[model samples]
Target: MTADHAPVRGEATGGLFSGTHAPATVSFAAVMFLTGFAALAVVPTLPSAAQDLDGVSLYPLVAGCFVAASLLGGVLGGHWADRAGAHRPLAAGMVLAVVTLLVSAASTSIWHLAAGRFLDGLAGGMVAVSVNAAIGQAYPDRLRPRVLALMSACWVVPSLVGPPLAGLVTEWWSWRAVFFGLAGITVLPAVAVAVVLRGPSWGVVPAPSGEGAPRPALVVATAVSLGAALGQYGVSGWDLRHLLCTAGALVLVTAFASRLLPPGTWRAERGLPATVLLRGLGSGVFFTLEAYVPLLLITERDAPPVVIGLAFTGAAVAWAGSSWVQGRLLERSPRHRLVAAGAIVQAAAVVLAIAGTLPATPAYTAASAMVVAAVGMGMFAPSLTVLSLTHSPPGRQGHASSAMQTTQNLGQIAVLGFSSALFNVFLGGGAADAVGYGAAFGLLLAPCVLAALLAARARSV
Candidate 1:
């Protein structure tokens, strides 16, 4: 089909695994699974890697590098997909992923490991945007949600096994083994992804002229990525240098980041703009909670590592299950309404988390917050993705997907920074630990509320 005349729904008959869709579907899922496994597995090994390299003081920077690099990756991948096709970027990202794994495996210094992580994040961002763009180009509107849900499902087994497996490897062998092993296992899958993308079934839709122009978007994305890294590092401490870093980050983002998003995104203009805004808000709320909740359980309640790990597992499972429900049972529901409902559910989860900060509440109450928030995300996140694709002008799905990824990263950085500030302020003011925790959790409600209020604007007029 021509760009302007692209079909709203795909012409494929039957389910994802049936007939012509099977190869692309299976290949994409395998890519996601490997990606998910590497992500989950690598995280648990960071502390050991940092300590062994004698970079304990710079741990936050090491961890934050991946997120920073992903912003650039997203923009690059999106533009590449728009100009060429999703397949090329997707295949390139897979290859880059393997290369990054090898880089990390061979790291001899803390900075080397950080560089590897940044490269991996870049690869991840490319892969993520390419997959979403592929879905938009290849699948019809009716099938998008299910495809997204299946992608979510691909992460489940990885979530269940990755960390523990990495932990065992780290404990039994060395942290490097995790990287080497991930690289070894993913090589074939990466090749498979490349081979699959070579097939003609993936609908290689390139954006029309003037629609997917790159120019300043890539530059803006780079600045925003740097700002995010600075902001994350800034919030790791409350020193004067960190404070100045934080201020600088805000300035950078405020100045250039909007150029990368839809016009009036900050104002939550109806349709695509609001959809992008909601992605940020919803993501901010969930990531903020995800970061702080485990810290609360560990420090305040003295919860064991096992308990924290289980909470993460539960959250992953809940996210997958909820995504399945939205894609399967509620497939006919309006996307905007589902988004609003999800926001409301997320608000409730935040409240539960706040309540858990009290001395009288059991520790599990706080831990359950992660799962609850994930449940909300399962519904909210995919609905937004579907809506974004639906509302995107024909041939511009890559641009839309890029905007969503950009804002999602910004949301995490902004929300986490604000909540961290609140937590630090309360603690510095001599408040009890519970009060500080309460303040941080309470700050998350604003985004949840804003997202709920603006959810309707995401609907296509």
Candidate 2:
């Protein structure tokens, strides 16, 4: 069905607010922030959870599964948003999250925890895609970028609150209490979204003349992208060594997603294409560096878990600070400039982390450098993202959102997957572990450099 066949609203309906409805903008932003908050809140308690549940290796599985499930959710949610409209999926998603947290907190086995996480991941995926789509459909072209920034900022909050909040809570009470705390906190916002999202007035029915028809190209691309994710996981897990698998997955996903993306996106020529490319570059390089930083500190530097967590926190804090600053100045800069600067900052951070591999440098020195790099990335994010959202055609806005998100996630999966594989190459022997991890870090440095180059070119082309 094309946009012409869909219903279009003649006048603006007052949404959740009293005068001109903000179209649940606040609700969407709140939901996103809460999602980030939940992620942080859960991690600190996860280990304590393991101890409470008879020491299962389910810790990694629980968190990993949630992330894995999100990949599924992000894809399906895009299509679902196309069909059912955003409100239903968005509302249903929140409810799903609530239910999952309850079950996760009450779990006795790893499977239960995993199941809850999967369900929650599913919901998060739905909320992210649907809300994103709604923002595209409901708002005028200009507001879209601002909304995307608001939405993206949702992930930033967890970095700030997730670690310490979880730390203090777990120390004072059982880790399980943290889950309960999250549950209690969610109720208020969930209810607010539910209330604000009510009535047909607040809803966004895909426009008849708009671009939201579900495309077969997207389904194929998502399938290929998802398969690629699985293949990358195999590589990361060391179960598969066929560079063919990783390479094949990347090619397939690239081809499929290209069809779903705008005309110039495959080549990443300029304008919105550049923005998409920056999103990929910034996220991939930033995360690839992040993935190994912990392992480096723990093994080579002999840092404790708390120290490792803090190092992670330092980068996250930097990330959050950047996000806050960028959001505050949403109207001032061109998107491409932000992307270019962010890319450079991110690459510099990777270089610093790379240098830290020398066994002699103070761990905090490397950590602090990474945090500084994150601040640069923060500058890059909202602008690059806002540019994409504002530029996307209404009919294809949902696809754009998914495409950008897919690129970011795929970046992490691919670059970090490679990082994981290389780290495992030297797993057992102490000497090998040091050398291997360093080599892996060394291998990825070029991409960050290349990404910076690409981001710089984003504006010109």
Candidate 3:
């Protein structure tokens, strides 16, 4: 439906925060900012935390556990939102986030840290899915792009300041303080969301799916989590047992993943399913490649940590800028074309990143590539999200939004896992670390190119 036809109050105002949604908007943005701040703040500390805990070998687990656990949270949260509005799950998710932060704050071992991260992921995943579903339900089509763009923009201040402040905190005091600080900061937003989201303006009629998680989806969510955990473990080890575990994980993931996504998602079935596929592909390639950016810059180029942090800050700004541009253009431009353009830019950035691996390449080359790639992701992500909401029927917005989250997470895990395994294989074969990094980056090219090819299929019918 066009702006004139949408069933919402803010079409004539052109202001995302106008009318009934202002309170909810503030609450959502606050939550996003807190999470964004905490994420950037804590990421740099994890390696140190792992080292101090003597769990350096489990570093990948610390990262993967969150994403793995999020799958369950996403599916379960979606089901809950569909069954009983978004208020309860969202409130519960926020509370869980606070608890998880405390858990991480007090951790004395790597296992404890991993457990904290896993629970954090669960809470975070639920909060993310619930918020997206809320947005889908709350805003009309005319406002969705702008609203989602605003969501992206919420990362701006956090991205700019979080890392440096976190560095100071880690230097002056303890890493545990960061977690405690974030937990404390989160309480305000949690309370505000619970209060503001209870009004009639935020009410959503429950979907027809009964009042609980679907048994099959819950089962699939469990399989996906297990598969992800096993996959991460499998790639980290080298024995025959590891190989067997890898094979089993793949089998389970392959068998059950189809149930979690829309039918024909694998084939890029036209319309909503294809949009979903593109979201996964774009996210998968970029994030998988992104994980190595700091490592390569610090290890290969000997770039200073400050420069590395600034590079990420620059990328965040670019992402928000691109999202704002897309929001402005949504009325005049077709989403598929925008997605295609973004995908092509992302692919080029990936190639540039690989070139930056050369010893003679400029120190800023990798940073530039990362920044440009962020622009592409920023442009496409909200567009696809808007499409997901517009395409689904009345009651299934939760399902569609949940599927998007699931696919994005799965994409990250699958691509990162495969590239990690390849990186290890190259290292085992005596390739230089630089060469392994290059090969790993090269592995991402396939999905990037495919995403560009399939972008047109994401067009709404």
Candidate 4:
């Protein structure tokens, strides 16, 4: 570690809200809350927007564009942070976020809306990476967990309110109103954060100098992002064209995605590699469940939309609560143990979801799957992040953070795509709907188990 890169221990004497850390902490938290609100709110409006634009067939492309663009954004933000400081990227991301919202609000066509979403994703990815890098640079090791937990908590209110509020606006007015409202509400706070971050105190630690940090390959990142988006669009339907697109996507990701990650990440090498891999595994399990569980309930169990909404709200609350426990009560626990326990808990949740696919099982059983999985993620996600930062070399925390972000997006794309393929195969084989759902949920167990087995690899040496 360089002299300036030394850990800033015991400097947070007055805590996160105290004199020194208050401005940056509040600014970051506020930005997170707004970003969460925009993300959760905008998703529910996309379907309505597509319908209004007469481009319903292209909805998957529109939806997937954000994730694709985020891959590029993560690399860009991480590189910028390492080369400069996290504060600049953070401010730039917030500004771009507001601009994207306005762009969406004025959209006259589906492609325009897709462009806005892609820009939003880019901004979101930058903000996410920069925030993690900032935390690594600004906070001490001891305070990082709490900061992460607080970041998780920022999502709780957004998850509870964003979707329903968007629904109401769409019902009473137009879907575009949501974008305009978000932009109007976000602009001032975004500016405030930008100004606050410019202060000398924020990102006080200078970036690591010399040849320790290597720049990420932007071309490969672009391919992976494009591949991920195409993969998502391909899976929306079953056709020869879609299959070919999916095949091409697989080739793109398989060929170049590994170059962006730490060495041995695929094999879960001990230390940082394992930590990054664990992020993917745990995220894959949770996201697959989140995507499928609600669909299962609505399609098979005849559950109401209100029921589904409440389930989402409950899951967010559970995640926040569990994150709180890990950050405070279990603050001293070994992170590897927490990760292992979380994986086991997630595996149990997957089992419950699978059981809910049975004819005799009640609808609530499946709806609860997301809440349970969230509890596990609450423990698993932050611990992996802490481990990644802890294991990172002096000047490479940005690289590690970017790799974690990249793998997380890849995990979502890969796991969800695979599960969707399995579900389609069962349906095409003339199996019953329950059978298809069962097969999909059944596939999730493997990753959860593997995460448990590899948790120890992430332990500090």
Is candidate 1 or 3 superior in lDDT?
Answer: 1
Q: After superposition, which runs of candidate 4 have C-alpha atoms over 4 Å from their true positions?
A: 1-10, 203-211
lDDT of each: 0.89, 0.66, 0.82, 0.88
Q: By lDDT, rank the candidates, best first.
A: 1, 4, 3, 2
Positional deviation of 111 in candidate 2, in angstroms? 2.5
> Candidate 3 — which residues are off by over 4 angstroms?
1-14, 206-215
For residues 1-461, write the lDDT of model 3, one tens digit per residue: 56333444234444667765677788989988997887778886888788889999889789678888888788888777776777777888998999999999999999999999999988988888898888877776777788889899999999899878887887788889989999999999999889988866455554555533233557788998888777877877888978887898899889998888888899999887898888888888778757888778988999987778878888899999999999986555888888888888888888888888899898678877888889999887888888887777655777787788889888887888888889899999999988998898888889877887888788886
Tally clashes: model 1.
1
What candidate 1 gets wrong by more than 4 Å, as runs, is 1-9, 200-217
TM-score per prediction, in order, is: 0.96, 0.81, 0.93, 0.97
The 10 consecutive residues of candidate 1 with the worst lDDT sum are: 1-10
- Candidate 2 to native Cα RMSD, angstroms: 4.9
Better of 2 and 4 by TM-score: 4
Clashing pairs in 2: 3-208, 3-209, 3-210, 4-208, 4-209, 6-208, 15-21, 211-395
lDDT by residue for model 1 (199-225), tens: 654554655666654445556888888
- lDDT for 346 (candidate 4): 98
